[model samples]
Target: MVNSLSKRCISLLPIYKKVPWKSIVLHPIIHPRFKFTCWLAAWQRLATADRLLKIGVQVPLECSFCNNAMETVEHLFFDCSISKAIW
Candidate 1:
């Protein structure tokens, strides 16, 4: 006799939940925005004492979408024309 699909899935539940976070950290193609946001966050974090002091780098920075005006994290993620279409 064959087991139901739900039974098979349930059998793997414990193993699935036990998987470590490190197992997937290096896997590519997980999520495009996840990688991009991580890179952007790292860049912002590592900017510098001088760059942070600059008006442009501090806040209201140029939009990554158009590269023609000021950018905010919101604009980069959703408000910009190019990114809004993507979302």
Candidate 2:
């Protein structure tokens, strides 16, 4: 199965491992299975593919913890005000 898929992406054969395939294709970083499901859901609510940057229609974009920097998918999970509080 891996070999068949690899053949389809032959042009990317050289540096596939370094390409963040899980994050780029499978979106594992965004859809983590268990531990961070709640956090992931929060991120999804904020930045679904069809809703990217269309913040005004939904909740405000400010960080819930800081009330400052825009609450993007990347920021909330990795670099936001509440992360420090939780840690």
Identify the leading candidate in terms of lDDT.
2
Whole-model lDDT per candidate: 0.56, 0.60
In candidate 1, which residue ranges exceed 4 Å CA deviation? Answer: 1-60, 67-69
Total clashing pairs in model 1: 2
Candidate 2 regions with alpha-carbon error over 4 angstroms: 1-56
TM-score, every prediction: 0.33, 0.39
Give per-residue lDDT, candidate 1, residue 35.
58
> What lDDT score is found at residue 52 in candidate 2?
54
lDDT of 2 by residue, 38-85 (tens): 544544654532355474456665776777687766666688768866
lDDT of 1 by residue, 1-87 (tens): 257877888887775444344335446866867655555544554333334546455543566457755564545555678877887
lDDT at 24 for candidate 1?
51
Q: Each candidate: RMSD to true structure?
A: 10.1, 7.5
